[model samples]
Target chain A: MRSKRALRYGLLGLSAALIGVGLLRQEHLEVLGKAVRICLECVGIG
Target chain B: MSGMRRNRIKWPLSRQRTIQLISAALVNGYIAGFQKGRIFTGGTKAVCVPVLNCYSCPGALGACPIGALQTAVGGVKHHFPFYVLGLLMLFGVLLGRAVCGLLCPFGLVQDLLHKIPSPKVRVPKGLDRPARGIKYVVLLVFVILLPAFAVTETRVTPPYFCQYICPAGTLGGGIPLMLADPALRQLAGWLFNWKVLVLVVIAAASVLIHRPFCRYLCPLGAFYALFNRFSFFQMSLDAHKCVGCGACERVCPMAVEVTKDINSPECIRCGACQTACPTGAIAGPLKKQSPR
Candidate 1:
């Protein structure tokens, strides 16, 4: 993969990892939202 | 027939449309998946959407950022919405309503509705700024103060903005939920009818006005405005490259004066200016970048 795309994927992975931890530890509405928020933040709104 | 020159017909395919669709899909998908589980277990935490979506809407996965913040401010406890504010700032620092342009499903829906061939209203400048402030009042008063003071419970409820005004809730979650479940339908009353009326009016207005709700009534948009000055993913106009032709402003559906400053709170980073500029003066990051 191109370096930029690869780097983007890496960042995505890291964010997902962090969000997954947040979600697993707290199943509450506010906690689950952390996962989606993280995904959008990393993706940069397409 | 003589050899006559034929005009090439170009298809209208803007990258903005692609972005809006993708964001909507992701948010909607998450909301659908989230309903199976409960989000609030004990404490009040904030969930924020980068775009102006409603939190109470059944399909919403993340708490509406504006809603959460308002509720926090409005609820009797009146605590700072650290998570919601932080999350909103995170996106604002990164995308700057590149979220509104590309990812907001509701914004996309409005855009699609505006596509209908019809007479449209270009809100005059005299009324525009004042109109934009309404959402802020919503953010401050309805979402924040009311819940903080008016509630029976000490915990903050989702702000009234989502409950009464968010068209996204009416169109995305309300309509669908009512259609799918009899229990939800039975629960519907004058309040539901009122929401439906509001949605219908907004939907109709969208055909004539480009993103009327985003232009005037989205508190989430107001929050993003605070970060536009330094957002990493933004349309920067190299003043040297910009000839001040005002082409960007002319094409902007939101009617933002792009060359005045790249950091205008009103700018949605729709990339219209980038395409419109003959000098290639405008550009945005393909991915979120660390703020400068």
Candidate 2:
């Protein structure tokens, strides 16, 4: 039971850390750059 | 008999359905944009919603997580999808498939289709068990491998799932775009027709089956299902209160054996089982639990 709790916390912590890194690196901007454009490829036009 | 009476009175708009409606409206609330047949290409599009809303949907305010993940992985730059992966992990740990049961726009569509009066068909367990694994295969192949490895000379990886599959994109983006733009109508070809066929099949099947796509084809649902056992918001069964009546099992849309595996990956956390429990054995979200 204790181990399970530890694992859960560990994963949550790791996810938070990853999110922090992603924000710090401004990966959201990269995603935004792609998203704002209507990609012809996504809609089966390309 | 009394339970049956209560359920019959509640009929078409059950508590869950009401929640589903509100969620669908809230998530896809760019109503004016839909009216104008324009997709919102705003800053919010960078952020991934937990649900399977097509990013190109006229009314969608946020990007689909599955679509964003594929796009990020399939880019020419091809860095790891840290933002998407982190968001998915965070959502999985927090809510699991509750997002599927309540928040997803596509999920609401399936639920409503299943509610239509029709002869129902349960997939035989023999075939169903193996078929459930297809979503994971989809996640592994279409979302991951094809994007990462199947690069072109220009270093661009194809968004295989969005291009070839994804009935949500077909229904939400393709139909709406074609309807709105006369020029886009000329661009429609074999691929567009194929996607329309796929959408029709899924839409037709949902009337007879409870969430055929979620059960067998949704990679997002498959991803979230992996966290069902450990998700913070989850259902628990009090053995002392349970009479082993199996009423919960009967009410489950996902067909989970509620008494045995309350935390089954297939369990959508819709609270039908909890509501159906005569003894009130099932409780949810843990924070709502009374002191033992």
Candidate 3:
């Protein structure tokens, strides 16, 4: 039970840290730029 | 064979089903864009949702984690997808495939279609076990490998999964855009036709099989399955309450052996097993505990 909880919260912490790294790097802006455009490929045009 | 799978319940709108509908609505909340034939271009669009909703869907308020991952992987400017991967990891750590069972719009579509009352088909375990691995293959080959390594003639990396395979793209993104704009219809070609064919097959298959796409093709579900075993909200089976009645296994949509492995990756956390367990052996945080 202890190990399980540790693994669960450990991964959660790692996820939060990665998100911080991503934001500091402005990777969300890249997602924003792609998402704002009507991705024709996603519309099955490609 | 699936006579008492889930349709017969204490209430018409079960808690999971209600959450599914509400999540779908909230994920695709920009309803005006659906009529206007335009995608939402707001700050919220940067945020990634945990489901397989297509970003091209006119009403989508946020990007799909899978789609955003592929886009970032395929981007020339953005070499790595820290944001999308982080978001996906966060969702998986939190809920695992409960996101599929309780939140995915495409999962809701499959569940509704599977309710159409037909002779259900269950694939033999010999084939089904092998078939389940296809989604992981899709995640590796289409979502990751092709985007990161396979360069097109123009030196641009295409999101191969969305362009060539995603049926959600056809139903939620392609069809609506085609209906809304003449130019998009004119633009539709062999790829669009292929997508429609894929959608039709999945739709027909859904009537006879529960979540064939999620079980066999959804890369998003595959990604979440990795975290299912240790995810925070996984169901716990009470050995003391279990009478080995085998009720839970029979109703499992994913064919999981509920008594043996209630927290299996294939178990969508849809509560069918919990509902079917006569002794209430299979209870989760979502379920009420019986007094000892």
On TM-score, the leading prediction is 3
Candidate 3 on B101-216: residue-level lDDT in tens? 99999999999988875668888899999999999999999999999888767666889999888999889989998999999999899988988999999999988888999999
Q: Ten residues in a row with the worst lDDT in model 2 chain B?
A: B1-10
Best by lDDT: 3
Better candidate number, 2 or 3, judged by TM-score: 3
| Tens-place lDDT digits, model 3, residues A1-46 | 8998999999999899889999999999988998889888888887
TM-score of 2: 0.92
A1-46: candidate 2 lDDT, tens digit per residue: 6776787788788888878888887888877776666555556565
**How many clashes (backbone N, Cα, C below 3 Å) per candidate?**
12, 0, 0
Estimate the Cα RMSD of every predicted model relative to the unseen true structure.
Answer: 9.5, 3.4, 1.9
lDDT of 2 by residue, B14-97 (tens): 666777889878767788766777778778988888888777777777888888888778787787888889989998988889
By DockQ, highest first, what's the ranking?
3, 2, 1
lDDT of 1 by residue, B65-163 (tens): 665556445544565555455556667667776777778878888878877766667788898878988877766676667766666553645456666
lDDT of predicted model 1: 0.62
Best by DockQ: 3
Which is better, 2 or 3, measured by DockQ?
3
